[model samples]
Target: MKKILNPCFLAGIIAVFSLTACRDDKMEETTPDQVQTANAKPEQPNPSEKSCSYVDSNWSWSAVLINTLPTTTDTNFMNSQMVNIAKMWGKSTPTLLFVNDPVSPGSTYNAASYKTGYRIYYGYAIYNDAKAKGGDIVNAMILAHEYGHQLQYAYNLPTVKENTGRSIDLEADGFAGYYLRRPNGYNKTDFSQIAAAYEFAQSIGDYQTTNPGHHGTPAQRRSAVRLGFLIGQYDVTAKDFDTTFFAYYNGVLDGSLKMVDNTIRPEIKAYLDQYVDELKKIQSGEISAEEFKNLK
Candidate 1:
């Protein structure tokens, strides 16, 4: 919910972009402290007090979510996988609200988390779009991502610094990657599914790097998820996880660390090195969604 400077002025330019209030900045995404107080709209009444509601009356926005997750035999993951996501992080389940705004179903094309309100909301339209793309895996990734913000609020986790929300969003994407691969989590041993989840992450990415709510470019988001899956190979305390994440992530973004750096441990660099080439391919846009799914 970071402030959109001029809705009327940018309305035309925003057709291809989302800007979901909290996550992407349209009707969702900002942390509580970052809510748009000036542009705030009164909460809209809905069928159930607990169901997700779209209240941004004055702002009409939308984004197409193109999911590239590999197919799964269990296509009903969206119905049962959310609770397991919370379990993976050892956090209490938050209230789950499905937003099927009768008045404007298309307007509910966003997903978000309320840290203080202790809930997560998924827009039914967005969920349906995801379901159509790759069944429930896409939606499961979304739920895991919103849950990542919950972990952030609970532990007051440190995030990579950026002027926009990209850092937190990318970190959330990373956490989703970890969940996708964890044996006790999604239990996906195959990198194809791990890659599948990242493709889902890519759908939410935007090119608005300077926008206050920019998540990340598609490639960067995929890289973040890939890094998280790599980390999932071992179990580490949250603090160590944070430490380890930044150690490599900073290098991934800025290329500050070299192959022979002392900061990265031998075992880690060795393990991570195996994927460096593919990661570079992603960042350079050499890989496509179809390619991502079929990769060995």
Candidate 2:
């Protein structure tokens, strides 16, 4: 059955997750020579020792995945992207820990294990499904989406006030969309590939009404992705990106009062022009409410 999440509870859930499970204050960078055991939960590193993982491999995101995507080629691209994105928020070398559970209990698509940098399980099984349905381009979208969360950590973006189901989840989805449209990494100028990934990710947000902590409903999730995509059509620094992101996001969660039509940021405005019509169509319900479901 479809689930509808109250915005407030979703905000609380974010806080609760932070307070109970997340260890943001404790995360430290890994050093080059330090070969810590994969599962060994180490204390947060000191200032000089912070290191980002630079895995090298044929494995798509094995560089970021703790043990699952192990490969020989250094995956500095992930580290580079994280570093570049984090710099905007004044963070350096945030630890990227990996959890090995095939089916991580709490949330899927990986989340920060508290303030300890970023935790990405990248479960092969999960990626397999995403690949089968969405393809590699779509998978790239997913990776970028998860990295967006890392940006949130480095910058200390305001946690949602209410832990309801919709706001936080949608915001993250929006963030993912925002990055996909950027030129640096994926360089996806068009929305088609990103949209498919967005839809694929949202479909897994299936839960009954009783699952209070479930992600947003399918419609809300789609809106979030569309919003992100709309924002992506323009170029902005990480600083500008976060500021605009939170402003628009808070506006979306609070009410319709946060509408923005200004193209004053000439560059952003120019980029957004490409997506204006598509955004309007989405806002107008041009897209069907299709969802992807996890096979039993």
Candidate 3:
């Protein structure tokens, strides 16, 4: 499991503008019927049906089993959603497991993808927490992000110049954004709800730019997803989407592609203005390290 935090809270004037931008997009307003149909709750899976069984003990990737199990309803729902996303990539569905324990201490969320046959292990705490925040769409987004890693495994994508994992992580964020905005996936036409759910993505942003495993900062992460969402405006296959995302993403990393001007998206700028200074402090090691870990 990876230890990650949630997006910073948008407050006061910034919160109003940020929330409104997310809520007021014209695209979201045009598809109320489809949104209702796509997001309708599914019948809970029966617990007696046995949702998951152990596949192998010596698999390339494995973890200690948590004592708790997800309810049949949750397991079935997650599996169904995984199937939907896999179809988007024209690949067979990957195995999904719901774990009870955290991957480590002081972490309420932990999820990992084993490249061997594209397996995913999600902690129950994270699953329940995502559902609580924004219904199943949030849960779907989390699963989609993990599946993004599987796509990397399948395609061997994102040839990175930097040794850090930020490139891979940000690409996965883009993949999730692409799927979330698609009609057959989450069918979330409104960019605002997608932006709101991105709070989860923002929270997981890390300030450890020098760390080999560092993911991008909150602002960078948000920008990546937004780029993906914009690209998703067109109908593109998964491979094509990767090509497009990498073209822009590589530019951002190599200092060739200019970063999107946040002034145009006032709401995003509002949130970033509030957090960027603190993030800089964390990155420079000027503040106590715990502050970065404890970001909420």
Tell me, by TM-score, which candidate is best.
1
lDDT, candidate 3, 166-219, per-residue tens: 887878778888888888777776667674556667656767788766777765
The per-residue C-alpha lDDT of model 2 at residue 208 equals: 37
Evaluate residue 127 in candidate 2 and report its C-alpha lDDT on the 0 to 100 scale. Answer: 40
Task: Compute the lDDT for candidate 3.
Answer: 0.55
lDDT of model 2 at position 108? 23
**lDDT ranking from best candidate downward:** 1, 3, 2
**Model 2, which residues run further than 4 Å from truth?**
1-66, 70-114, 158-160, 206-212, 246-257, 260-286, 289-296
TM-score of every candidate: 0.71, 0.56, 0.63
Clashing pairs in 3: 5-203, 5-204, 6-203, 7-202, 7-203, 22-192, 28-190
Q: Kindly list the per-residue Cα lDDT of model 2 for residues 114-168, writing each as its tens digit.
A: 3343543343333444556876655555555555556555565434434444444
Cα lDDT for residue 207, model 2?
Answer: 42
Task: Please report, as a residue range, the 10-residue window in candidate 2 with the lowest summed lDDT.
Answer: 7-16
Ranking by TM-score: 1, 3, 2
Go through the candidates in order and give each one's C-alpha lDDT. Answer: 0.59, 0.44, 0.55
Query: lDDT per residue, candidate 1, 1-296, as tens digits?
Result: 22222221111111213222322233443352222223445344443421332233322222222111122333235535767887777766676644434333444456667755676655555556656676666667777877788887777765457787777877777777777778888887677865546665675566767877677777788878877778788765555555566766654454443453455556766787777777767677777877866655
